[model samples]
Target chain A: MLDSEVPQEGNSTLAGHKKAVYARGGDGKMHLVQSAGWEVEEIVTRQAVDDLLRMTEDARRRVEAGQTSALEYHMHRVRMDIPLLAQASGIWQWRIRRHFRPAVFARLSPRLLGRYAEAMGLTVDQLQKTE
Target chain B: MMAFQHSQASHCESGVMASMLRHHGLPLSEPMTFGLASALSFAYLPIVKINGLPLVGYRMPPKFIIKGLQKPLGLKMRFETFRQPAAGVARLNELLDAGQVVGLQTSVFWLPYLPADLRFHFNAHNVLAFGRDRASGDYLLSDPVAETPVSCAPADLQRARFAKGVLAPKGLLYYPVGKPQTPDWQKVLPAAIKKTTRIMLDAPLPIIGVRGIRRLAKAIERLDAKNDAARTKLFIGQVVRMQEEIGTGGGGFRFIYASFLQEAAELLARPALNELAEQLIDIGDEWREFALLTARQIRDRDPLAPAALADKLRLIAEREHGFFHALRRAA
Candidate 1:
């Protein structure tokens, strides 16, 4: 998980592995790297609502040593897997339903339409049928 | 005991009454759902009456499958009494040793909150516990979540991985083969039906409060007396809600129906109430048989979709409802 706190320059220098680095900013937009070992800066934190994308070397070491949950270490990977699994299950459930109910598409039309509208943060009635 | 008054009851109505007898009643009455389940299960496979009646799918997951076919013809499925944490691993080992226990569904058994130190990744569901590797000593299992079959060693299978719950041996839950063309099927059906009916009638109390039926009956009576059509409709909704709670949304329909009967304990006074009770009972009976047949068919076909089975039941319930309404007027 990314922490919001700005990285200390002294700490980055002490790690001894300084190299020009680039990162995606908190705004989900990419940023340019100017100097060696670019740490999460105050400007990034101010621009993004979410915490700055920074996992200090010390925290990384602790997690690698099995001191903390991989839940934090593999947060991004886990988050990516969840939506994929849900989508797969939904497709499978739909296929199975279709096998049993030949008209499953029509049968589930109302329910799916309502769900999708809600998901888009819109009401069901707002979905106009565009022939 | 005075014979239930039949001056107004006709032969057709009496037949309907027999088919619709009140299957469920009160807080502790026999669980109608179990009876329904047993009778239905008995339809497809000759269910060996281990306990009084057979109970299918009414219980929760990681359903235990015991070893060795006890009867030559009948199928026996059991539920283990207690649970242990290392159950998934242990059960996998036992089924491998048995050789006959194929097509298993694996799932995680733990709570949401877990300790940091004791973390293991083994919360898998619908995994088929099939073959095991001899040289590597790895268990060949089907991981439904992955939608593929795989092999995993004991270490790879962790106890703390899934939710936190002890997975112990329940009972042997295997479908037994019954005599293919036995004349005794007729004899067995009634025995299994009666036994299952009694068993279900005996098992529900906790979820459906003791006084649930009484309250429903009161509400129904008030609505009917006031001649308030809308309120009566609302009362029907309340009954449906109560049914859902007691039946676990039809999971425990028999028990819920029984509770309804209990609430209408004084139904002897009103012909209509008495008739409605009977109709519900018959519906439960048919549902039990239908559900079992569906479960059996699905079980026979590997990786059967339960949705298909549920659809079959919806059709059966719809038909039964028609006969039920016809009897309501006479009662």
Candidate 2:
């Protein structure tokens, strides 16, 4: 959990780190603080502080760029998250086949890799090696 | 008080159960009541039957082929394929607009292929035309992948797709028209003789060695360094791979696939797999079974939760390395 009251220190929604952010108040529980737009980190983490921090970074980056809305920034974050997602999906595929052997690998097609990549926030390049 | 472990034992037990249920064309949704009965009867015996000359190596379609098709059935007589989640959904919408039924084939890709240390594909496949809300255009789907008929709407569809691209919805648009009818028993078996072994005859069986492992490992390490979302991403990767491995072809693959699907369905029902995994560990086995079965309560409103997915994937990955090591030793 992150502490929002720690102060933004003038980090507008348009600058600095652009991950997601989540916060927890003095009540000892977590809460979402300033969920401006969908940041890469926000979509990944459930904690409010994490979401807040990520969102703050995203907002600050967009704000500095003089962008109109957070949605555009979020879409951009979506692109960056793709490779990570793909890698994650790869890990998941590994778990599914934990008990099997090359037969599964032989059975897996390229299309499945692409879908798996999308789910895990990865790109085809990451999911499938080029060379 | 006791804790339920998602250990290898649970996975194995679940795998064996899945194989038997599938063999009987039974839905894995059977409760512990039946499971306990079977256990007491010691009726869970393995039956091996010899067939024609064993077909050679495994065969898969090209990535282009898998990704090119709008749905899994779209790959009729073709090798495996995949598509971008949004694009896959868009294609699904297109197929549904055309009025067709679909079939989804999902799997865990990694467990079986760990020896090669290469990338694997694992995910669920949902086939059926989209049933949409005429007003909001929210779509609906029916997946023939499970023991029982499974259906979901657009929002849920997107969530599942988001959770892992493993879920492939191949349109068998003509289901309403005429899909050759098979016997009831045939439909229930895991290795549906006709369908499971229908790989292209001329397809090459290449042994994928450790060509990609170094790179995959590096990428995982980088993701781990970020340490924020990497674990989640990596976890999902492992799970997806595991699914693909099971969905592929292996002696024990069907059982493995069944266990994960049961777990995935269970997770899909609860807030998420990790949450349930964490809570189940302290709740003991009986309560855990209830918790697992409660996963069937997945509602249309709940979207596929990726964060929770990542959490579950992480748990799966933590224990997965051992299995991979075992595979390596066997190989």
Candidate 3:
């Protein structure tokens, strides 16, 4: 039977979050036991979040400098890669890459822009804005 | 509507499956549900990148739990994924009006109740929506990963359900379509165990199962001072993320599998499975040790050679390879 003592490492720390672990109860059935947060898990999650924010910040700078379109920035903000963005928007991979360019993105038809916007959960106007 | 009892689970898919089955009057523990589904596996795909790092998975892709349960247990389930968000929301409300608790696939990053640090682009997170308070526009959610039942704003839940990314939820929803017949554990248990063992031991691709572990170890071993520190750290971080953060239960689902084996031992009347379970636990501990060492190296900004890290990983790979091989023979 699995022990009730939760492993000290790599546990999540979301408020009131308990892990349903297995333990041998008095009835000899493997019952679910609740376990609290582990410090290691919290640290790993925090690090991942930090990495994502850093990527988003970099994308924001690129958009500000006119190196990429607002769509590209929003993609990074949502932790998406080019292929994933393309798949989600139902756009061809190469077409999505071209759309990353600000000039090309600006000239996209309303119908095309709508697909990208909806995929990102944003309006067309919001997709056009870097902020 | 069935009164859903929310139990925090170590992993999302298995937890949701267990809870849903129980509500339908099939009282299967999370590990039993996981084992019966044959949900455990390992894959390290170098070509598939997530966040600029190679993808490493400790379990099968999403929806396998739902799919795997069908034949063995004779469960009838309905699953749908929407192209239009509005239609998806309408369908969900329609189901709610009929007093059915619905299972939804959503992106973790878009779920408001998650800590900012725990939020990511993962879109395969599963939750059960039991009811909605019309006045507050908050849906009562039974998120297996959460400590307790939580309330989600309609807008927030909508965004989560339709979040765009790899493995996008696309407003996916599923539920039981009919009552499950009594399962034939005698037939189901052995079949599930054999399939899992075969998949882990005999996958054709080198990037899956025991081969994948070795492949990952070799990749880590190949890292050198020639590689930039940032690149090395990113790779290590991704491994850690796959192993620890992606809901593999503690120790990359090792403990959960051990629990399953312990249970299986009783069910099959095979005490040898209990011995194997303890061995699996030891392998899990080694994985934890590896994570701890890697984390320390990264945090301390230690200038240790990649060879040292590679050595540690190789040891883990060897142990895992041995354990799975023995498990195959024992089964």
How much does candidate 1 score in TM-score?
0.27
The per-residue C-alpha lDDT of model 3 at residue B191 equals 80
Worst 10 residues of 1 chain B by lDDT: B6-15
By DockQ, the best candidate is 3
lDDT for each residue of candidate 1 in A36-111, tens digit (9 for 90 to 100): 2122221111111121123323334545564543222232222112222223223343343332222332344666
lDDT comparing candidate 2 with the true structure: 0.29
Task: Give RMSD (Å) of candidate 1 vs. truth.
Answer: 27.9
TM-scores for every candidate against the unseen true structure: 0.27, 0.28, 0.88
lDDT of each: 0.30, 0.29, 0.79
lDDT tens readout by residue for model 1, B68-116: 1122113343323224436645665675676633333222222112221
Models sorted by DockQ, best on top: 3, 2, 1
User: What value does the interface RMSD of model 1 take?
Assistant: 29.8
**lDDT tens per residue, model 3, B1-331:** 6677988887889989889888888888889888998988888999877777799888877899888998877998899889888999999988988988889999987788887666777888999998898899799999987778999999899989987767778899999988876677778887887788877888999988878888887897776646576677668767886887745676777778888988888888888888888788777777777777777666755664567777777787778778877877777
Superposed on the true interface residues, model 2 gives a C-alpha RMSD in angstroms of 19.1
| Alpha-carbon interface RMSD for all candidates, in angstroms | 29.8, 19.1, 3.0
